[model samples]
Target chain A: MAAEQGIDPIHQFRIEPIIPIHIGGLDLSFTNSSLFMVIVLGLACALMILGTSGNALVPGKIQSAAEMSYEFVGNMIKQTAGTEGMRFFPFVFALFMFVIFSNIVGLVPYSFAVTSQIVVTFALAILVIAVVIIYGVMRHGTHFLKLFVPSGVSPLLLPFIVLIEVISFVARPISLSVRLFANMLAGHITLKVFGAFVASLLGAGAFAVIAPLPLAMTVILTGFELLVAVLQAYVFAILTCVYLNDAIHPGH
Target chain B: MATTETAGTEAPGAPHEAAFPPFDPGTFSSTLVWLALTFGALYFIMKRVALPRVEGILQTRGDKIRGDLGAAFKMREEANQAAAAYEKTLAEAKAGSQALAQETRTRVKTEQDAKRKALESELNEKLMTAETLIADKKASAMASVGQIANEAASAIVQHITGKPADMTAIAAAIAAAKV
Candidate 1:
C-alpha cells in the first residue's frame, strides 16, 4: 500500500500557480482556477455551437438541451424581473451558465472549483449588486431610496424598519457569496474526508474490510454534492434576478 | 510519528489555516483578475454569439408557426367561399328548371284549346250540310208524290165515267193530306 497521507480534506482547495507572472508589485499568475474557468467557457461555447449548428425546424438532442437551458434562464428572469428586466438577459444567462459549468466541472476527479473561492463568488455577487444599484439609480433616481423604507409604517417604527432593511440590503452580497462558497466548500470537504477515511482504512490491512463503509458514504456524498452543485447554481441565478427586480421596479 | 509526519508535510499552517483559503489575502487579487477575465469572456460570447443564435432559432420557429396558421385560416376561408358559390349555382339551376316546366305547360294548354275550337267549327259545318240535303230531298219527294197522285187520279177518272181528272185538284188533295 502507498504511504498514508494525513486525512487532510482541505488540501484540495489550495491554489497553485501554473504560470507565475509578476506585474510591478502585483502577483498576477495563471492558476488551476483560471484553467478550469477557461475549460468551463470552452464547454459552454462548444455546447452552444454544436447544439445549434443544425438549427433544424425539428431540433435534435443537443439542440433541445441548448434551447432548454436558454428558456430556463429566460423564464427565470421573466418570472423574477418581468419583461423589462429581460434587457439584462445575457448577463443573467452568462452568470447562470458559468456557475453551473464551474460547479459541475469541479466534480471531476482532479479538477479545481473556481466557485469554491470567495474571491470569485464575492466578485460575482458584487457585480450583481453593482448592476442593481446602477440600474436603480439610472431608472428611478431619488425614488430608488423608497426601497429602503417600507410602506404603511408609523413614523416611530419607520426608523427601526429602515435600519433593518438597510442591514439586510447590505448583506445581500455577503449572503449570496457565502451561500454558494460554503455549500461547495462543505460538500467537497466531506467528500475528501470520506475518501481519506477509505484510503486510511484500506492501508491498515485488517480494517480494510470496513473500508466500504466510508467508501459508500463517499459515493452517496458525491451524489449529494452533484445535487448541491446544480441547486446552488440555480439559487445564485434566482437571487440575482430577484435583486435585479428591485432595481427595475425600485418600490415594493 | 506517522500522524505528525503526515501533518507536517501536508499542511504548513495550523490545522484550521489550511482548510479555508478564501480568507487568504495573498491570492485574492489573482483570483479576482482571473474571475473577471473568464466571466467577461463568457458574457461577451453569450451576448454576441451563443444566445443570439438560439434566440434567432426560436424567433424563426415562432414566425413559421404563425405563418402556417395564417395560411391554414386563409385556405379555410377560400373553401367556405367555394362552398357558398356551389350552393348558389345549385339554387339557380333549380329555379331555371322550374321556369322551363311552367312555360311548357302553358304552351301545351294553348295548343289544345286552339285544336278543340277548330274541331267544333268543322263538326258544325258538317251538320249544317246534312240538314240542307235532307230538306232538299224531302221537297223533291213531295213534288214527285204530287205528280204520281195526279197521274193516278187521271187513270181512275178514265176508268170510271169521266176521262181525266184535273192534276191541280189531285195535287191539292195530296197537299191537304200531307199537312
Candidate 2:
C-alpha cells in the first residue's frame, strides 16, 4: 500500500521552488504554483484574443463560445443583482473565468493547483469584500452601517439582531475564501490518493488482479473532480454576488 | 506534544521537525510577484480591450434602438399626413358631387318650366280656334233659320193663292226673326 510510501495528504501540500530568483534581498522563488498561475493567465489571454479576433455577427466556434460565456455571466449578474448590478458584471465575469481556468489547468498532469492555497483564495475573497465595503460606503454614506441593522425590528430585539448581523457580515470573507480553498484542496488530495492506489495495486505482482477496480474508480474520481473544480468557481462567484447584494441593498 | 513525538519516533520516514512551526512558504513573495504580473496584465486587458469592446457594443445597440424609434415616429407622421390629405380630397370630391347635383336639378327645372309654358300656349290657341268655330256656326244657323221660315211661308202662300211670295215678304220675315 502507498500508505507505506511515507506520503501523507498534508505532506502533499509542500511547496518547491522551480527557480531561485531574488530581488532586493526578497526570497522571490518562482514555485510550481507560480508556474500554474502563468499558464492560467496565458490561457485566459489566448481565449480572449481568439474569441474577439473574428468578431463575426453570425459567430464562428470561438466567437459563439465566448458569446455564450459572456451572456451566461451577464445573465447571472442580472438575475442575482438586477440591471443596476450590471455595473459589476466585468469584475464578476473576470473572476469566474480566472478561477475556473486556474482550477482546470491545475488538473493537468504535473500541475500545481494554485486555487488549493489559502493565500490565493483569501486574497481574492478579501479583495471582493473590500470592494463591496468601499462601494457601499461611498454610495450610501454613513447609512452603509445600516447593513448590520435590520429595519422594522422591535427596539427590544434590535441589539441582539444587530450583533448577529455584524458577526455574519464579518464572517463573509473567511467563509468565501475557505469554501473555495477547502474544496479545491480536498478534491485534489482525494484524486491524488486514489491515483496512488491504482498505481500501487498495478505495480504489485499478485494484487495486480485487483488493479482494474481501483483504476476504474480513479477514472470516475477524475470526472467528479472536474465537476467540483467548475462548481467551486461558480460557488465563489455567487457568494461574491450575495455579499455585493448586502452592499447594494443593506440589511435583511 | 509528547504523543506526537512518540508517533514521529514510531514512524520511520516521517520528518523529525516540529509540527507547530508554521510553513514558511519561502516562495510566497515570488507568488505575489507573479500574481502581480498576471493581475497587471488582466487589468490592462480589462481597461484596454475587453471593457472598451463591451462598452462599444452597448453604446451601438442603444444608438440603433434610438434611431429605429426615431424613424418609426417619422414614418408615423408621414402616414398621418397622407391620411389627412386623402380625407381632404375625399371631402372635396363629395362637395363637388353635391354642387353638380344641385346644378342638374336647377337646369332640369328650368327646362321643365319652358316645356310647360309652350304646352300652355298651344292649348290656348286650340281653345281660341274652338271658340271662333262655335261663334261662326251660331251666326250661320241663325241666318239659315230665317231663310227656312221665308221659304216655308212662300210655299204655303203659293199653294193657297197659286203664286210665289215676293222679295219684300222675305225681307220683312228676316227682320222679324232678328227682333
Chain A accuracy of model 1 expressed as TM-score: 0.96
lDDT of 1 by residue, B44-150 (tens): 99999999999999999999999999999999999999999999999999999999999999999989989988998898899899888988999899779777877
Q: What does the lDDT come to for candidate 1?
A: 0.84
Taken over the whole model, the C-alpha lDDT of each candidate is 0.84, 0.73
lDDT of 2 by residue, B1-179 (tens): 11111112222222224341112334445555666666556656754776556445445656878999999999999999999999999999999999999999999999999999999999999999999998999889977987787778788778888977785877797677679
Regions of candidate 2 where Cα sits further than 4 Å from its true position? A1-12, B1-25, B54-179
Q: What is the TM-score of chain B in candidate 2?
A: 0.62
Quality of candidate 1's docking, in CAPRI categories? Answer: acceptable
Regions of candidate 1 where Cα sits further than 4 Å from its true position? A1-7, A204-213, B1-19, B98-179
For each prediction, how big is the interface RMSD? 9.1, 8.8
State candidate 2's DockQ: 0.12
